[model samples]
Structure formats: structure tokens, C-alpha cells
Target: MSELLQLIKQAAMEQVESSKPVAVMIGKVVSAAPLEIQLDQKLRLTEEFLVLTKAVVDYSINMTVDHTTESHTHSHSYQDDSTSRTTQPHTHNHAYVGTKSFTIHNKLKVDDHVILLRVQGGQEYIVLDVVGGGIL
Candidate 1:
């Protein structure tokens, strides 16, 4: 009976160890290309082991814009000669219209501290965002 009880306790302990209890952890980026993170002094996770969120990945957004602007200008001039004197005043108004395209880039760099969420079964970690050194 004692032997059976010991076996049941051992099984429960094995199950608990296999299923990691810690769901969230902090990590520091050690590499950018072929990304890698250091979870602890002895545990380093490679790129394949991580799933990156937009906040931690390098990405770009393309945008197009069309708008118009109005402006006004005024000028005054005075001239005098031996026989004549005159003054001229001028005013002008104009509008500027155009269309443009641009891109916004977002990226992450090395040495950034990030938040990580461990996927169920503990096989992968989702990089939520960079918490330190700012997201690039």
C-alpha cells in the first residue's frame, strides 16, 4: 500500500514539472538577426522558439495622402525720380494642392528588454513588446 502511494505522488510531481506554472516572463534580446533571447543565465531561446508580435517585429506601413492648402501674400513698394513719384501695393492669394505617398517603418533592436508569454505546453513564447530601450 505504501509503495502504491509513493508511485501516485511521483506521478503527480512529474505532471506538475512537465506543465510549467510560470506563464509570463521577462527576457532580453541578445541578437536581432536570427533573433535570440536570454531568459536566464542558463536558458537562451532562439528565433524559432519565439513568436513575435508587431510591437517587436520589423515592419512598414505605406500610406497615400491628398490635400490642399491656401496662402496669401502682400507687398508694398515706393519709387521716386527727379520728375515723378509713385507707390504700388500688391496682394496675391494662391492655393497649393498635391498628392503624396510615404512609408512608416517600425523595428526592434538588440539589447531591448521584452515581455514574453509562454504558449500552452511551454514550447513557444510570444514576444508581446519591448519594455526597455524602446521599440525601434
Candidate 2:
């Protein structure tokens, strides 16, 4: 019985080793071609067949006053006014600044650089980080 078990284990190991070369070949085939071509060929489809009809939407970074801070942090709010005719009201708030209002005690100064990240939904642009205090 022990000898039979050993033989079975050896056969399993050999099978795994023999498939390594085939796996490597498949990897080479996949990496040799561009992703778009490979997907089209593999799925037997064309780009136009899978084309999306949704309208392309674009976002732009905008700056506004920080009116919700009282100490060291600043805050700003953004609203999308593009689809005002639609039923959905698109608006969001972001507290990028740490204080409730911008004050002289904080690191932020008037005309300082504020980074706004264009995000999808909820808070569109959040304060990533603050820079440029020496200008003031």
C-alpha cells in the first residue's frame, strides 16, 4: 500500500511539471500581442460591437472660497450646474480645510495654493493638500 501511494504521488508531481511548459507558452502568447487585439480575437468580436453609447462626461478642477472654517482648516463646496434642466440635483460638500474658517493663525494664507481632486459623485473635489505659505 505504501509503494502504491508513493507511485501516485510521483505521477501527480510529474503531471504538474509537464504542464509548466504549456503555461509558459500561454503566457508568451498573451503578452506577445496588444491587449485590445488579444481580447477581440479571443472573444471573436469587434470594437464597434462592444462600443458604448453613453455620452462622455468631463470634469474640471475649480477653486472657491473657504467659508466653513474658524480656526486652522479651510473648507469649500462644489455643485454641478450642467444638468440643471434634469430632475436630479447634483451637489456635494468637501471639508478639505482643517479649520472651520480660514484665520491668520493657520498655515494657509490668502492666495495660497489649494489642490482639488475631481472625484465622481458625493464630494467631487476634496482638498488633497495645502502648499505655498511664504507668499503671504
Maximum-lDDT candidate: 1
Tell me each candidate's TM-score.
0.58, 0.18
The CA root-mean-square deviation of candidate 1, after full C-alpha superposition on the true structure, stands at 9.5
Separate clash counts for every candidate:
0, 8
lDDT of 2 at 136: 14
Question: What is the lDDT for 106 in model 1?
Answer: 42
Q: Cα deviation of 1 in candidate 2 (Å)?
A: 81
Report every candidate's CA lDDT.
0.75, 0.33
Q: TM-score for model 1?
A: 0.58
Q: Judged by TM-score, which candidate is best?
A: 1
Tell me model 2's lDDT, rounded to 2 decimals. Answer: 0.33
- How accurate locally is residue 67 in candidate 2, as Cα lDDT from 0 to 100? 49
Clashing pairs in 1: none
